[model samples]
Target: MVKNSGEGISKSVLYLMSAGAGLVVANNYYNQPLLNLIATDFGVSESAVSNLPLLTQLGYAFGLLFIIPLGDKYPRKKMVMIDFVFIIASLLIMALAPNLLVLIISGFFVGFSCVVPQVFVPMAAQLAKPEKRGRAIGVVMSGLLIGILGSRFISGFIGEYFGWRSMYFIAAGIMLIFWVLLKLKLPELQPDFKGSYKALMQSLWGYFKSEPSVRLAAVRGGLGFAGFSAFWTTLVFLMEDNFNYGSGVAGTFGVLGIGGALAASYVGKLSDKMNKNKLITIATLVMLVAWCVFEFSGHSIIGLVIGVILVDMALQSLHISNQNIIFSKNPDARNRINTIYMVGYFIGGAIGTTTGAYAWQIFHWQGVASLGVFYTILILIFHLVFKKSLA
Candidate 1:
């Protein structure tokens, strides 16, 4: 295995990194489809169990702000391996937790450790040739999208048949196997920033202040993701209320979102050759159109499916373009820049989740659709206001 910085990333290495990212990120979402099952097992109300996702996302946001920047100051492989150990431990804790409190805490740690995928993203960007950088990130991000969308399908099935706790046991075992593979095959990357941890974090603020592209990209990504999250979170409600479907049917939407995964790599490659601002404008319009489709679909599965494809494609395209812009500017501080962007991204997701739930409580599916369009409009406004600045 190559251990030096001079070694170029091979296709095999890219595939391995992509797979690793998917596996690690899957930890955060496994609980989503299993929330009801978990609540039943622990004798808690579904409302109470809702805190689990909130806590988990909060932990993920925390890790993005604090743990991800460490990639700039440490060998990324070592950091990732260490994180896998925590991931395994956290999953095991959730598997064995006898009560909701323990499960919540363990879920937080699982989200915290799952930030390993973010580490891999910057590492992939850094290792690729400049011409292939966007493609590389796209491949890894496709894995991430698959994990995010696929976890619901996998966990829902597992929770139904094998039981929810069994899903955690299986996940912990999978993480252990991934940890071994990373140790054996992942290349060692030297620290780009030599500084104290405090200073490392302080530099994040400096990047936020000094890097206009980072700030712009973060806002665009965060808002775009807010719309994406609003749609997905309320989707279950739409399926159950209007279509009279269960969680299993809701889970199938994850399978449908594979359309996004297929498009991600292509979108990344396109971002490499195309003008990013124009790409963002096109993506933003696509997202707005997707919301319009959802607004009019009214109980049509076919319409929902088409809207899902368009929304996921649009969001993933904008995300790759944003990352390409941010990473291209700062070769030495990719991790920190990613931290800023992703922290904003996850925060937006949290806001979207909350907004979707509230909207559903008020106006049902139409409210949710409106919420999504509002967030997408914010993305367009940001793009238009900053187009010259971005140029």
Candidate 2:
């Protein structure tokens, strides 16, 4: 039987959360492969279309900062269901958008609603038995990882065949189906904090001010991610420009990059068993190598494949590892802590997307690869200074 608050979650509900989180989060990524199509339809330059992803990520950052804390003050199930309503509307707007302005505005809402998956993550944590919490979170994470890895590939093929709008249409339909499923399957969860919105916001700032570890980890992970985001933002453009390949070919790289994402989960486990400083240090050094490969050899497919794997593995390592550090600091404050860290994270993504597009417009692959190396170098500098916390 399905359990209520703090009791064990049913296997079916757990699977639903996993699938729901995956599909919902995938909404954030579907645009990457479709950027080429978006550019073509709008008759805009690569730099212009880049704003779509950039704005979406910025929107996600804003939502993380602002909306996440509400879960602490209110029932989660109702909040998620409400978020889905907005997501559906946004996806529909995107599917039928008449102008770039409309698409960009709606894209932001999509990212904002994309925060729903994050809500599911914490919900899974609360519902599973203490002994099984890790496994539960891992199951959900696996779903998330698969959704991320598969979205590009799925969207690429769909966008190539049925028109880019169809992808959004299909995504909207899936969200609608899940919306109904969740309403039926999910039990209402109680609020963890009884604080007002003002106090919640204040506490987040307090953590940022007081936690040296949060600061270090957020900075290290954010800037490091900016570089990798640049690569992803520019990858489709690269495929089209250099190899005369389409979105489908460009997206297969997502599949190839799965190794890196998997490597991140491994590093997350190691955070408990290994020294944080040593673990991150090695990951940083590995990131440098990935960027160097991109700079020198990214023109070739084999080189591109290798660089993608290495960079993803390295970037995701920083994410999972840094996240572990923050979560360890104060259990009661995890929601707020996650809010601050993710805000910085997605903000970095927005900047990287902008940088990638602008770089591609001018110097092409060399510029993209060079800036990536530069970002990795900056991460290394920051890590050395912040490595104390990792110890």
lDDT of 1: 0.85
lDDT values, one for every candidate: 0.85, 0.80
TM-score of each: 0.95, 0.92
Give the best candidate by lDDT: 1
Model 1 Cα lDDT, one tens digit per residue, 1-391: 2333255578888889888888888888887777667877889864467677767877888999999999989888888888888899999999999899999999988888799889888888888888888999999999998888888788878887789899999999999888888889888788879889999999999999998888889899989888777776667657767887756677678888878887888999999999999999999999999999999876899999999988988998999999999999878899999999999988888788777767877788899888889999999998999879757
Clashes of each: 0, 0
lDDT of 2 by residue, 1-391 (tens): 2223256767887778878878988898899998989989999877788889888888888889888878777888899899999999999999999988899898998998788866776676667765455445555665676677678888888989899999999999999999999899877777767778999888888889998888888788788878977888898988888889998887788888767655543565566567767778888898999888888765699888888888877776676667666766565566677788878878888888888888888899999999988888888898898676546
In model 2, which regions exceed 4 Å deviation? 1-15, 124-138, 263-265, 389-391
Quote the positional error of residue 361 for candidate 1 in Å: 2.2
